[model samples]
Target: MAQRLADLADQGCPNFFDSQRFGKDNSNLKRLAQWINGDINVTKRHEKSLLLSALRAAEFNRQLGQRVQNRTWQTLVPGDVAILDGSNSHFSVASVDAELSARAAANDIHPAGVLPGADDSIAGAPPLLAELMQRERLQRAYRPLRLRIQQLAWQFVADDLILTMRLPRGAYASGVIRHIFDLQSD
Candidate 1:
């Protein structure tokens, strides 16, 4: 399927087509290039359709990109992610924190009691305790899958694009996309 789309995109697909995940058919696709031109003419419907296709494309891109990213634990400080080193041990960092959170929530964990906010003062508390709280929260966020990698392969058709992502066992390919979309997983 992707090979076909790649061929189509390379030559310019002569007709509109859609991947079931993206849409039925995009009437607005032709208009996407209009924004780059000077003085565009668009009726209300054309503008709306164009906007929809662009939005869908943006969403598709976002999800596709995450496939190569590492899944982190949640209860983090709202920034940064928990990355796993080759040893499979986890470390924390900034960026893609939402992915961490989603992983945690999926595992039925939350950050509330895990993180020791600055105000926390317990007698002889280990300095690392605070850090541990934050990371443990991330551990809970894991979605039952051990650390793994996902990848998105793309095929562009003259009409539209098809995106593909393969996930690890116990991980949901579509569930990952739900990170960006409000749509329920079927």
Candidate 2:
């Protein structure tokens, strides 16, 4: 069972953001658009923080969409930030090589995209994504573009199935659920 769990974890999960990220009626996104348009004037620290987060999340989602369209969301690209599985540590891959592709395919490393911010530490991103970061005034930072489940187990009970799993800190559960279910919007 332990080996099976490890094998399952190595299969990897989609690196997409779920609806919960957009908030109720995507109000966070509306707030972000307002801030981008200079229509919002925030004096409170919390308000500023939320707006910043919304801005970043919006950009991340946009980049994720592009990756999915390009069919590279599950694979590594040249000049991509490859994040090490289970660690915050990551390094830039200047070019895609067979070994790197194999490693990424094995779920040992993940390709990351930018989380717009002004931080100087965020480096080695694709040119277009970096440009978008500057235009959005999002601090340039990298976030693992993938999520890997740990200790995942499942069983069928009657007509329903139950899953037990652990995700890394900051990983969203909705991403995993989406793969197995067609969630509806209410």
Candidate 3:
């Protein structure tokens, strides 16, 4: 069991925020919008936290979707903050050169998207997005563009394929599973 745990830790999964953070029908997000627009004042700390989480998740998902659509989620763009795989350290790419592109392609590093927070380190996203964030009064933060899967294995049993793996904190198992199967949630 100890060895198994060690192996799982050695291989980390992609970092993604799970759906639990977003309430059903995104009601929390709607409430957050009301608060941001000054239509409501959130007094409870828990409620405020939920709203903040929803907003951050929404922003991160938007950026990730954009990158995936452009076929550049695995690639890097200018002014992108690239995080080294399996490590927390990251750097800003002011320009895309051959070496940097090669590194990104090799998964040595992946581009990160802003999480919309108060003290973001780098600032190079689209101006329109920035404007929107400004209007929403969100802070700036960075999050990786890609989610990595490691030590992935599966087996079929009784008409079910059991998948076994480990994911790093912030990565969602459902997010990974959804990619493999068309699942419907109740």
Candidate 4:
């Protein structure tokens, strides 16, 4: 189990926003959809913010999921927005070269996925999210697709495994756990 964990740690985890970002049973996302379609109105500032956050998180997750499916989550692709490690700074990729590939492999940078909003030109955005962007006039952004796990350590106590690691801000611990265990969220 320890060796397996080590191997998994070296591979990093998909930078997915865990279920908590969507609220209970993803109620926030549902509400955002309702508001987008004009079926409901969100007037409160905090409520509006929450709905917007959920929308962005959902879109980011969708984009990251696609990269994972295509086995490109950890590799550089043409036209990818690459984010600098430990920073929000990112740059658009015109093409993938050896330097970019090496930086990605060394965890010096990561491929970013889009957070849908106004002026987001990336094609194939979901119609609902695109509509929300058009209605809200929100600014688009990017988030890294791979999360690096630092100082990973694990131990067994009384037949239970305990894991510890440091993740960057806005990163979910469950993102690491999912690679080692099957997680079901309610």
In model 2, where do residues sit more than 4 Å from their true spots?
1-8, 119-138, 184-186
Q: How well does model 1 score by local distance difference test?
A: 0.36
Write one digit per residue (lDDT tens) for candidate 1, span 64-140: 23432433222344433333312323445354356766655443222211112334433444454334334333223
Model 4 ranges with Cα > 4 A deviation: 121-135, 184-186
Estimate the TM-score of every prediction.
0.26, 0.78, 0.74, 0.88
Candidate No. with top TM-score: 4
Q: Write the per-residue lDDT of candidate 4 for residues 6-64, one digit (tens) a residue.
A: 87678678899998899999999899878877899888889988998887898788889
Point out the worst 10-residue segment of candidate 1 by lDDT.
9-18
User: What lDDT does model 3 reach?
Assistant: 0.69
Range of the 10 consecutive residues with the lowest summed lDDT in candidate 2? 120-129
Residue 144's C-alpha lDDT in candidate 2? 74
Each prediction's total of clashing residue pairs, residues at least 3 apart in sequence or on different chains, is 10, 6, 8, 0
Per-residue error at 81 for model 1, in Å? 11
Model 4 clash tally? 0
Residue-level lDDT of model 3, residues 1-186, one tens digit each, is 334334333433234566777877778877876776668877887787678778788768877777767777777889899998877788989999999988876668888877766443224443443343554466566777777666767666877777787665677888776645535555
